[model samples]
Target: MSRIVIILACSLLLVACKSPEARRPISSKSGSFIDASVARNIKLNEKEQAYIKKIMSENPEEEYIASENGFYYFYNIKQADSLISPDFGDIVNFNYNIKTLNDDVIYTKEDIKTQNYVMDKQELFSGLREGLKLMKTGETVTFMFPSQKAFGYYGDENRIGLNVPLKCEVSINSIIDN
Candidate 1:
């Protein structure tokens, strides 16, 4: 049975290697291409799995509810302050930092020394859209997004592999238009 599993895993990796995108950017230094197929086979430690499952089960403490995408999205608002931003119909400017569940910095505007974009809510996941709706100009919020509402089971292996949990902190600097 183990042999069969190994064969199946190897086959999946081989398939990943044959893709056009696969030839461009491999995942890690180990030379393994981490695509949806690879993420499915990537072994998760018991602690990693447990932590992700735990985040999946958390609930918010305020009137603002998460996107119901099954991930816990929390915020840190100063007392007597509420988060408000552009409506779903408006565009907003935001800076952010993305990290692995283990707290490893995967991507960040500060680190990359750049800013992120959400074009009129046209190209973002559910959690990102919902999180922005809950923020105001000059407000900073941290969001914990599970794989489902995020990249889902199939992610961009060149950027972020599948089944990998992610955490992000977003700072809404200004609302250019609304």
Candidate 2:
């Protein structure tokens, strides 16, 4: 009986000493979903860019400059005398109207109302935020943004639709330095 008890204890100790086994997932991902999404986004960006290019080409009278931040803009009222646009942390008072690429109005200046944006400190859309930095006081510029630059996959949750590019005319009333 004593020998049996000692053997059982030894067996139990040996069993407990076994290394933990790694678990095999029931289903493994091949990363297809992420790859497909990336490919789709790339294709979408290309199509939007081509369309914007067409619009620019068609409008020979309007001079549009492509921004480094992946948008296009032309000055309706350019202030050449101002040496610099609004810097970071500046309080910018502006008004803007939104439109589709086809020039369909989504939001009028009165509908949106005048905006007071604290540069790089407020919760504004990515494109408009970047666009504001390129504007001086009393300058109005019309910006053409790709969907990704504007709102990306999610629209404005109201009038704007999914993956819709936009044209916005922005006028800066004043820029108060912070």
Candidate 3:
């Protein structure tokens, strides 16, 4: 009986001394799906950029300045005065209209109405959010955005479709410092 109790104690001690093993995943992922998706997106971006270049060539009459932020623009109404542009927290009153590269109106200014955006604080789209930073009060600029800048994989979930590039005319009514 004493031998049996000693054997049970030895077995329990051995069990407790066993080291833990790392668990292997049921299924291992090779990341091939993510890699393929990234490659596809790159191709799509190149195609869209080429399309934008084509449009720019066709409209050589308008002097469009390529923005460092991956978009293009031309001032419809430039402000020559030394008025300050909006900073991080400034309030901007603006109106804009959206159109396709072919000049098809997607949303009229009335459709969008007036927008009061806090610079860099609001949930504005990437393209226009950066575009607005270049404007002063009473300046109207026309911006041409690539799909990546406008709406990438997911569109606006309304009129703007998937990966649709956009042309927009934005006019800043006022810029109030906050």
Candidate 4:
């Protein structure tokens, strides 16, 4: 009957409109798409790292220093004398401005209150933590972080996008030793 044909046609259309996840080709042996996704992520990460390095090289005036863990930084206001840098469990109060490698301002000191963190507490991004450890109170530094050291592949999911590198200028206001 005409009603039966109409129903079958609608059902066919519904199946054809299935979500992308349902339509994705599955691997015959593994039965999942994780391998392809991971490969794509790896490629993206490599591209991000190369881009950060190129940016650092282009800015000769900044005098960026590369660290073993892949973060790049240079002091804008170096600490004087033999001032002690923060150690584990020390609480630090600071102000910062964070931008993307493309120079898009993501956050600034004016956007929020003074940020504070306990040293080596994992309360901050890996690159920020590492840079802070090397700085003494009242010092300011500008740092560049590859995606892996900042937000990784997922990013902050808000101001930052996937695989995006970051730049931050931080001023250490005070350190409260525990």
Q: Number of the top candidate by lDDT?
A: 2
Give the per-residue Cα lDDT of candidate 4 at 56.
Answer: 74
Ranking under lDDT, best-scoring first? 2, 3, 4, 1
**RMSD per model, one decimal:** 17.7, 1.2, 1.2, 11.6
| Cα lDDT tens digits for candidate 1, 1-178 | 9999999999999998984753555554653554654565444433444676565455334333345554555455432354455765565767787788767888876764534455454877666676777678777666767665566567756677875667877877666554
lDDT of 3 at 122: 88
Cα lDDT for residue 132, candidate 1: 74
> TM-score for model 4?
0.73
lDDT of each: 0.64, 0.94, 0.93, 0.84
State in Å the error of residue 55, model 2.
0.6
Runs of candidate 1 with Cα error greater than 4 angstroms are: 1-67, 77-83, 111-120
TM-score of 3: 0.95
Q: TM-score of each candidate?
A: 0.56, 0.95, 0.95, 0.73
Q: Which pairs clash (backbone N, Cα, C closer than 3 Å) in model 3?
A: none
Cα-based lDDT at residue 12, candidate 3: 100
